[model samples]
Target chain A: MTTAAITVEGLRKRYGDVQAVDGVSLTVERGEFYGILGPNGAGKTTTLEITEGLRRPDEGTVRLLGESPFPRNPELLRRMGVQLQASAFFERLTAREQIRTFASLYGVPAERADAMLETVGLTEKAGTRENKLSGGQAQRLSIACALVHDPELVFLDEPTTGLDPQARRNLWDLLRAINDEGRTVVLTTHYMDEAETLCDRVAVMDHGRVLRVGAPSELVGELGAASLEDVFLQLTGREYRQ
Target chain B: MSAEAFTSLSKAMALGLLRDRTAAFFMLVFPLMFLVLFGALFKNDATARAEIVQVGRVEVFDSLPRDAREGLEEVLEIRRSDDRDEALEEVRAGDVDAVVWQEGDEVRLRYSAADRVRAGNARALVDSVVQQANIAATGQPPAYGLTTRQVEDESLKAIQFLTPGLLGWAVAMGAVFGSAFTLVNWRKKRILRRLWLAPVSAGTVIAARVGVSVALALVQTAVFLGVASVPYYGLELSGDWWLAVPLVVCGTLAFMSIGLVVGAWAKTEEAANGAAQVVILPMAFLSGAFFPLDMAPAWIQTVSGVFPLTYLNEAMQDVLSRGQSWGAALPVMGGLLLFAAVLTAVAARLFRWDDA
Candidate 1:
C-alpha cells in the first residue's frame, strides 16, 4: 500500500484580486500528525480545504491517498474526513441523531456512531440538541462526526481557534491518541505551542506560501531559538498571533 | 448512495421544519387563517342585492302583481320617495343603486353608471318587472316564458371559485416560502458546505429538498381541501377528486422551483425573504385569487395568464367546481410541468455551494 496520505504540487487559487493559495506544495505521510501553522489570512484553511477535495484549485495537482481530489471523485471523498472551521449541525437534532445521520450517509453501522461519540467524550450529552451545545462541546461533536466513518486521512481546519485552554488541551490529547493509532492527521492553526506539543511535522506559512517545513524541535535548533515561537518569529519576522 | 442520502436528508428536513415554530405556523396555520378570514369577509357579497329608489308614481310601483314584485325583490330592495330630484340625488351620491320613475305610460331608470355591475343587475330586474306587467296586461298565456334549473354538478357561487383560488394560494405559499427560506438559512449556517464535503452529491441534496417541498405542498393542499369542504364552506366539488392530487403536485412543484431559483440568487436569509415576497405578492394578486378574472381589466387578466398560479387556480376550479375530468385540465397541467422543469434547470445552473 502507498504510505503517503496527501501530496500537492504548485497548488494555486485566486479570489478576484487576492491570490489566496499561491503555488503551495506539501506532502503528508501515513500515520504522521502534520500541522500547518500560519497567521490569519495566510491561506492555511484554503490550502487544507483544496487538499481535502472541498474546493477546486485554479492550478496544480493534489492527491489524497494516491487519488486525485479534483472533479469530486466519490471513492476518494468516501475514504477521507474533513472538520471545517466553525462547523454547524442541524439545529433541532440531538447529537446522537445528527451523528447517526452522517454515519448512515457514509454507510457506517449505527453502533459505530455511538462508539465514536464515546471516543469524543460526548456520550453523556448524546441527546442534547446542537443549538444547545456549548462551544467546546460543539467542536467535539464536529470531531466525532469527522471520525465516525474511520477514514484513512483526516483534515481539521483551526479546530481549536475559539476553545478554552483546558478544552484545547483535551482535544490535543484526543488527536494525539488518534494519530498514535496510525491514521494520518493534518490540521491548520496559528498556535505555536499546539504545533510543538502535538505535531510530528510542522509547516510555517505566510502570504499564501510555505516558508519552512521540518520537525518543530529541529527547526528551533537550526534557528538557535529558545522555542518554536521564537523560531517562527525569527523566520517570519512577525509575532505568531499576527 | 444517492437514494440513502436523499431519504436521510428528507427525513431530517421534515423533522426540522416541524420543530421550527415559525416555519410551522407559516406552513400550517397561516394559510388556513387566510382562508377563513377572506372566505368569511366576501361570502355574502357573491349575490349582492341592488338598492333602488322609486321616485314617482308610488301607486304604479305598488300596482305590480305580488309574484312579479316578489321576483324583483330577490334582486332589488326598493325604497319609496315622493320627490323625484331627491331620489336622483341618492343615486348620484351612491346612496342607492338606481332610481325608478313612472311618467304616464313609460317607466324610466336613472342609475350611476360608475357602479356598473350593481347598476346592470338593477336594470335587468326592472326590465323583468316591466315584462311581467306587460304579460299580465295581455291577459293570455305567455308566448315566451323561460325556465331554468340548477345543474347538479356545477357550482355558481363566488365562494366556489374563491375556495380553489385560496387553495392555490396556500400551495404557492408553501412551496415558494418553504424552499426559499430553508435553503438560504441552511446555506448561511454552513450546512450545505458541510454536506458538500460528505460523499453525497449535489444532485442528491437538491432532490431531497425538492422531495420535502412536494410533500409539504401535498399536505397543505389536503388540509385546505378538507377544511373548506366541511359544512361551513361546503365546497361544491365533483368529478374525480383524486385529480386534485396531481394538480397540487404539479402546481406546487412549479412554485417550489421558483423558490429554488430565489435560493440560488439570495446570499442571505433576509435577502431570500425579500425575494420571495417580490415573487409571491404579485403572483397572489394577479392569479385571480382575490377576485374573478372577469371582474378585472383585460390587460390584468392577460398578464395574470402568464403566472403558474393562474393555471393552478383554473385547474382546481375545473376539477372541483366544474366536475371536469383530468383530461380537461391537461393544458394547465402541461404549463405547470413545463414551468417546473425550466425553472429547476435555471436554478441548477445558478446554484453554488460556497461564496467563491
Candidate 2:
C-alpha cells in the first residue's frame, strides 16, 4: 500500500531581505521519484533542504514518513539518506574507508561498505583517497555513501549538476535503479532534460513558488510548449538568471 | 556516546594529522628546535664560573700560594683596578661577577646579590683561596675570612625554568590551535555536516574530536619530556613526576574546549586560525612560556594570572622541578578543569553543523 513519503503545507523561509522559500506546498508518495526544478535564486535547494530536515521553515508544517524532523529525529535520519550538493568526507580516508566510516555510524558492518562500493561501480577505486578521485568518481562515491544504509527515502540536491554528459547519464541510470528498488527519491535540479528523463513527477518552481506539479509530459503539455525548457521559459519568463 | 563513533572519528583525525606535513612539523619539530637552541646557549653555565676585579695593592695575588691562585684564577677572571671606588661601583652595578680587596691581614670579597649564581660562586672561590694562603703562610686557618650569601639555590638556572615553560607551551599549541584548525577545516569541507546528518549526535562528534585531542596532547608531552630530560638538556624530572600526566590531561581539556569555542564561532578556516593565534600568542608570552613572569612588569604578571596556560606552566614547574604531589597541584588542576567546564558549556551552546 502506497503512503505519503513527504508532505509540506504553507512552508515559508526568509533570509533577511530575500524570500528564499515562500508558502510552498507539495507531496510525494512513497516509492515515487520526484523532482523540483527551478532557476537560480528560485529557492529549489532551500525548499528541498527544508523538506529533508536540514533547514527550519519560518512558518509551515512538514512531515517526513509521518514524523516531525525539525529537531533532528534520529529515527527519521536512520531511515533516510541525504546527499548535499557539497557533501565532503575526510580527505585522508580511502573511498572504501569513507563508506565504512558512515556505515559504522548507522551500525552497519564493513561488508556493506564493499557492497555499496560495488553497486556504485566504485569497487575498483575503493583504495583511492578523496583527493585522488575524479569529479565524476567523487559524485558516484557520494551517492554510494548516501544509499549505504539502504534507506527508505533519499534526498539528492543537484546530484548531476557538474557532471559531463556521459557521467550524468550513468547517474541517471543509477538513480532509476535505486528507484526501481521501491525507495522514494527526491531531487532538485535546474536541468530540464534531467527532470524530464529521471523523475516520475516534476514540480516547476519560480520565485519561491511551485508554478506546476505533475508528470514531466503533463507539465510540458499543459503549457502547450514544445519541451519542458520551453514550458519553464514560458512560466518563468525569458530573462537570464543572475 | 557510541564507542565506535569516538574511535572511528579519532582514527580519521589521527590519520589526517599524520598526512598533514605542516601539523606534524609544528607539533613534533618546533618544540624540539626551541629546546636545542636554549640548551646550547647555556651549555657552559653548568660548571660554575665568576669574574672578579681587584683593587688596593693587588700584588697580594703574587703572595698567594701558587695552587690556590691558579685554582681561583681558573674559575675567576681577576683584573687590577687603580680606582677602588670605581671598581666597587662596577661590583654594585653587576659589571663584574665579584670584587676582592685586602684590609690589613683580612682579604675581603665584595659581591652584589645581582647575578646571584655567579656572585655566590665567586665568593666561595675567593674564600677558599684566602684560607689556603693563610694556612700556607702561618700554618693556621685565617682569623677573618671572606664571606658572601645569595638568596637562591644554585640549581634553578634559566634552563631548568625554561624546560617546564616550553613543555607547557607545546601542549597548549597542540591541543588548542591544532583542534581549532582541524574543526574549522572539517566544517569548511562539510565533513562535520556529513557527520551531523548521520545517526550520531553533535555532542558525540565533539567528544570524538576531544578524545583525539587529548591523546595527541599526551603523545606530545611524552616526546617533549623524553627529549628534554636527556643528559644533553639535563632536565631533571622530580620524584613525583607522574603527577605531570594529570596536569597535562587537564590542560588539554581546558585548551581543547577553547578550541571548540573558536571552531563554533568562526565561519571560515582563515578566521579560525587567526582567532586561535590571537588567543594562543598572547597567552603564551604572558604565561611564562619563554621566561618567568617574575622578571616582567607587575601588570603583565597580573595579566598572566588570567590564562590557563599560566596555571599549566606553574603546575608543570611544581611537579616537574619541585617534586610536588598531586595533592599540592590541586589548585592548578582545578583551575584547568573549571576552564574546561565553562568553555565546553559555551561551545555546546554555540556549535553549529553549518557555517555560522
Candidate 3:
C-alpha cells in the first residue's frame, strides 16, 4: 500500500508559557488538497512550521513520504516545498534571479526556473526586483520559488492573508492548478470560504488543537450547519472571527 | 548540492551588496575618504624650518665656522634685526619663532611659547650651536658623537602607517556591518527559515556569507593600497606586503564572526545596528586604526591588546609600513583564527532561524 504523503502524530510544541501546538495529529493522503483552517494566533503557522521541518516538535513524530523530516533529511527536503507566511527573497534580486537562486539550491536548471516564473504569470516582471513587485505578484513569485523544483508535496502557510479579493481568487486558481498536477498540497488559511472552495478536506483548528477534520460539506452537514463558519461556531460555541 | 548552493548564494549576496548604494558607500567610499583626507593632511615630507630673528650682529653667529653656519642656516631661516625691541616685538607677534642675541658670554633666546613645537625646536638648535662653539673655544674634540637612523625605509611617510590602519578599519567595518545587517534582515524577513527548509546545509549558507565578505575585503585592500600608492599619497609598499592578504582574510573572519554574534542576538534591525556600532566604533579608536595607540596612556595601550583589531592593525602596519616578514604576522593570524573560532561558536549557539 502507498503510504500517506504526510503523517503527524501527537505533535506538541510550547513557546514559553504558551502551548502553540498542543497534541495535534493529522494525515494527508497523496495528491489530496488539504487545509488547516484557523484564526490568527490559533497555532496554524506553528503546526505548519513543525510539519515543514523548519521547527522541531517538543514531543511527536512526523513522517513525510515515510521518512522523518527533522535532523534535516535532505532527501525528504528535496521532495517537499514550503512557502512561509511572509515571502522572503534575496536582497535586491530580481524575480528571475530569486527563483533561479532557489532552483540552483536544489540543482534545478535555470530553464525550469524561468518556466516556473512564467507559470506564475510573472514573465513580464522577470526583471523587476522582488521589493518592487506588488503584493499579489510577490506572493505568486514566492509560490513559484517554492514549486520551482516540482516537489511531491507542498505546504503554504496563509498564502493569501493580506491579498485583495481579486488577487486571492487569482491565487486560488493557481493553487487549484498546482493541486491538479497530482501533487499533494497542504495549506493553512483563516478564510472559511477559501477552505470550502479549495480543500478536499480541512482540519478545523482553534486554541492550539484540531477541533475536527472532514470534507468541508460533510462537516457542515454533519453538524446541520449552514457553512464551515457555522460549523466552527457550532463546534466551538463561539462566533467565527474570519 | 551544497557546492552549488554556496556558489549561488555567494553570487546573490555579492550582487546584493554591490547593488545596495548605501552599503557600497559605507563599505568602500567612507573609509577611502578618511584615507584621502588624512593622506592630504600629512602629505608634506619635509621637516619644517624655524624662522628666527637675530636681534643684533650676533657674535655667536659670526664666530661659528663657515660649514656650521651654513648648516644652521638650512635649519633656521635667520634675519638680522638691529633693533632689539623690534625683534622682540616680532617674536611676540608670531612673525618670527624666536629672537636671539648675545649678552656678554651668555646667548639669550626669547621665543613665544604659543607655538611650542617650533619654539622648542629653535631652542634646541640654538643650544646645540652654542655648545659646539664653547667646545671649539676650548680646542677639544667632542667626547661622543651621536648618529641616528630610522628603522623603516626613510621614504616611508605618515601615510604609509595611516593606510594600513585605515584599511583595517575599512575591512572590519565591511565584514562586521555586512554580516550583521544581512543576518538580521534575513531573519526578520524569514529568509533564514526559507533557506533552512531547502536541502542546503547551514554550513553552506554561512560559508557563502563568509566567502563574500572575504572577497570584498580583498577588494577593499587592493583599492586602499592602490590609492595610497599613488604619488600624491606617497605610501610605499615594501617587504612581504603580500602577507597583508592572509592578514586581511583572517581579520575579516574574526570581525564577521563578531557580526554574526550581533546578528544572532538581536531581534530587530535597530538593535543589530546599535550593537554593531557599539562593537565597531570603540574598536576602531582603541585598536589604533585612527591613531597610534603608543601615544595613548599605558592602561589604554594595555586595553587595546585585548581587541583582535589591534593585532590586525599592528600586523598590517608591520607588513605595509615596517616591511616586516611573515614571522611578524603569523602569530597575529593565529590569534585572529582563535577569535574567529570562538566567536563563531558563540554565534552558532545564539543562532535562531526565525525571530520566533
Report the number of the highest-DockQ candidate.
3
Candidate 3 scores a C-alpha RMSD against the true structure in Å of 2.5
lDDT score at residue A71, model 2, on the 0-100 scale: 92
- Model 3 global lDDT (CA atoms, 0 to 1): 0.91
Candidate with the larger lDDT of 1 and 3: 3
> Which digits, one per residue and each the tens of the lDDT, describe model 2 over residues A158-177?
98878899999999999999
> Which tens-of-lDDT digit does each residue in B127-241 have in candidate 3?
9888878888899899999899987689978898899999999999999999999999999988998888888888898889999999999999999999999988878888799
Which lDDT tens digits does candidate 1 get at residues A5-83? 8899999999899999999999999999999987788889889888877788999899888899778788887888888
Candidates in order: C-alpha RMSD to true structure: 3.7, 4.7, 2.5
Residue B1, candidate 2: Cα error in Å is: 2.0
Q: lDDT by residue for model 2 over B1-356, one digit each (tens)?
A: 78786777778888877778887788768987887788778766655568888887744576766886787677888898878889889988888987788788777778899888888888877776665665777877667776785443455555667777888888888888777877788878888767767899777777777777778878877877887778777777777878888898899999998888998889887898889899999999999888777878889989999999998988888888777787667888998999999998998798776773
All candidates: DockQ: 0.61, 0.63, 0.81
Better of 1 and 2 by DockQ: 2
Instruction: Give the residue spans of candidate 1 off by over 4 A.
Output: A239-242, B47-134, B148-154
> Which residue pairs clash within candidate 1?
none
The TM-score that candidate 3 achieves is: 0.93
Off by over 4 Å in 2: B48-74, B77-140, B143-159
Best by lDDT: 3
Docking class of 1: medium
